[model samples]
Target: MKLSVSDSDLLGLVHLIRLYGKNLSKTWSYTITHLIRKIHDQEHFPVTDMVKKELNADSLNKYQRQKLNRRLENDSLMIEHMIAVQSIINVIMKFQYSKNDNDAIRELRSILEANTNCIIKFAIKEKDLKGI
Candidate 1:
């Protein structure tokens, strides 16, 4: 499957790669390089957000608010969870799709992806995987 990114979003990714190259994987670096080369090849294809277009704010009622308050008060458990997620990712990332990386990636991606207007999405072709 092919994915297209906007000049605005592409510039954002370029900025992130510039600031955090050490944290990014080779697959990401290689893909971003390709994206940069293909920037001029862009078409005006409108991309949609990967999230629900509308959210029901009515769900945030009294009970939900109370539960949220309790969760915020539970610092020890949250800290332990953070530590576990940190260990899950490792000092240097080995693989981004392993079981150990799942929870860490899920939580971080949940927040970031949820907030993204439109994200750059891609699948590494099998032939290119080994090289990355």
Candidate 2:
């Protein structure tokens, strides 16, 4: 689906990535985790609390199971948004960490732009234009 991300959301993401890059001493895993948490924290979905409860449950009642399943579908869709952004960042980081290869940088830039567009498309697909 063609998702359309808002200008603010796009700028926010770019700013976040740049901020994270300032701390180059951090590992990629740590940076990605922080980014994911930041993204997840910025949005509030009513079903999120229930989903968390269901996740922690030892056994789900029929109603809870059904509700959790429905909510999870939405959650998974949002997760795709996160994954798309993370993937793009990962590619960009790889380029940054690599030897200065113009060819590699060009290839990575193409991939990053494509993935960034995908994230924007996913954002547009969301019921509310609030990005991931």
lDDT (C-alpha, whole model) for all candidates: 0.33, 0.43
lDDT of each residue in 68-129, candidate 2, tens digit only:
55765444323324335556566655544333344444444354445532121121234454
Model 2 steric clash pairs? 3-120, 3-121
Note the clash tally of each candidate.
Answer: 0, 2
Candidate 1, residue 70: Cα displacement in angstroms equals: 65
Question: Over the stretch 10-49, how does candidate 1's per-residue lDDT look in tens digits?
Answer: 4454344445556777677566545433431342212112
Question: In model 1, what is the error at residue 36, expressed in angstroms?
Answer: 1.0
